[model samples]
Target: MSKPGKLIQELNRMVNEQFATPEFHHFLTLPLNRDRARFFVTQSAHYIKNRRDSWGYVQGAAPLDVKAIIWKHEEDELVNDPRCNSDHYTLTVKTGESLGLKREEIDGSEPFPAGRAAFYAWLHLAKDRPWLEAFAASAILERRNNGKIVRGGSLSDRIGKKWVAELGFKWDEMPDMKIHRDADEAHSDLMEMIFNRHVKSASDEDAALRGARESLEIDRAFRGALADAMEKIS
Candidate 1:
């Protein structure tokens, strides 16, 4: 029976390994030509929308205090933020415009099969698992995006930099990713607080780790599917 702090540290290390997975690296480093960029940005919108669905399940299953925390988190994601002036989905479409994508194109885009499977997996955990396990599963995604947790930088921060350096887009032009770079740090901390308060037993810790690890595996598959899609774009 490890302490909660040690349990969280182990979870963090496990989730960080997702970034080092070959599939994740392959997707992140994929060349961002116009076609690929359009595909990426469009699929990103699908991913963001899936987050809304999955989080709704988590919010429903969570304890009242944790639900309150998630509600505030959703205020920024589902509603307007001071930094973005719109919800995250709209912000993603706005970012796509900088890549020469129209609102219609992004709105009409469908998620690849692997991405859909990943979303369903997340929703299953959020809706069917115990509250702590479900919450940890959902929160681990944001935690993995916390550059402070990950050694180099978060997924959003790293990808945002790549867009700036390789795709010739300015940071300001990609408001969604830019905001996530900062926002997920706080989001991750909030989740940790939940874990500290709730995860008291060895079984609870094991459940949390199981949910987080499974989600990361789905994440890798989703990223790999995206990379394969990008390669096929002509």
Candidate 2:
């Protein structure tokens, strides 16, 4: 009835699982008062920093066309996307100041060592794997975040809700995150299309599926580690 994908069936199964859990949403919804919110925002900075590093390395190994796509993606991330006047990382740090995070506080000592290692390990996979697989790994993270794909709710929606209920900040108060909340949906969709379109053969599909699976597995650990650290943060 339809074209069979080398990996889409399995990849879709794995991708759906990422959303089927309340774990990610729980991390955001857990009642963190102002002091905890302060820590949560600070910790979020560290996680975004790791995201930048992994994405940069993934772009480094992507095919020319996919690289161009990611380059545009990074324009919002590392460079200016015109959508945002500055990089998202800078936008995030500035957003951090709202919750009382100074640059030094964010950059200051005390990050989760295990989380840090996992970030580097993701980069290694992006750098070492074939272009499709590498790109698939990075793409799945956003796919996991995309509300349209993963179900339950997006990471951004959950985070935004928690902020509203806890901190009393309107959506306009954190403009950058609000934009990413929507834009990442398009990004993840574009990436999944790439995976689907290019898998002309079984092996290509297998590689892409492998990349998606491995990335999702690592992400579960990474999120768990971050949640643990946030829970323990004094």
Candidate 3:
């Protein structure tokens, strides 16, 4: 098989293993309550903002061609998508409304201490690592959220369903979650294309995988922290 194909397989394996981890499963299986839902929606907006910061760092550090790719990826995120009629943060705020959250509440909320640490960890990777590693770290989150890649369902799909079943939310009501459920597939594809185009050497592949693995570890920690916070929301 081709080098990129092999690398993709390796990446897929890493993601699959991530899903199987106890921390991941614990976070996913946590019961959703109204208070928890509000907390999650509010905190996730902060999480999304952290993503914007990390991606900006990555874009600043990337090569010209990779910067172009990152810029295109940011179009649907940072800018208003004519299709959705909103950008990602706005969409999250809209989702927050369903949880009885005001835009101000979400916008003004502080990141939990653990969430703050996780965000900094991600930012460190984006800023300090090689562009390939930084790109891989950011892309792995989307790739993990790709239902086509993850067995059973993606994170967004699973969480969306939980909100519906547990919280009586309509699928259409959570625009941000629904949008990511579909959009990350295309995002993952784009990242994979970049991997294929740029990752030609063993060292490059190792760096990419290292980034993916470390990012996934941080993701698990982030989710675990969220779960802990959710449990305390009563």
What TM-score would each prediction reach against the true structure? 0.96, 0.86, 0.97
Model 3 C-alpha lDDT per residue in residues 68-130, reported as the tens digit of each score = 988988988989766587798999999889878899989889999999999999999999999
RMSD of each: 1.4, 2.5, 0.9
The TM-score of candidate 1 is: 0.96
Error at 59, model 1, angstroms? 0.9
Instruction: Please provide the root mean square deviation of candidate 1 (C-alpha atoms, Å).
Output: 1.4
Rank by lDDT, highest first: 3, 1, 2
Worst 10 residues of 3 by lDDT: 80-89
TM-score, candidate 3, is 0.97
Position 114, candidate 1: lDDT: 80
Candidate whose lDDT is highest: 3
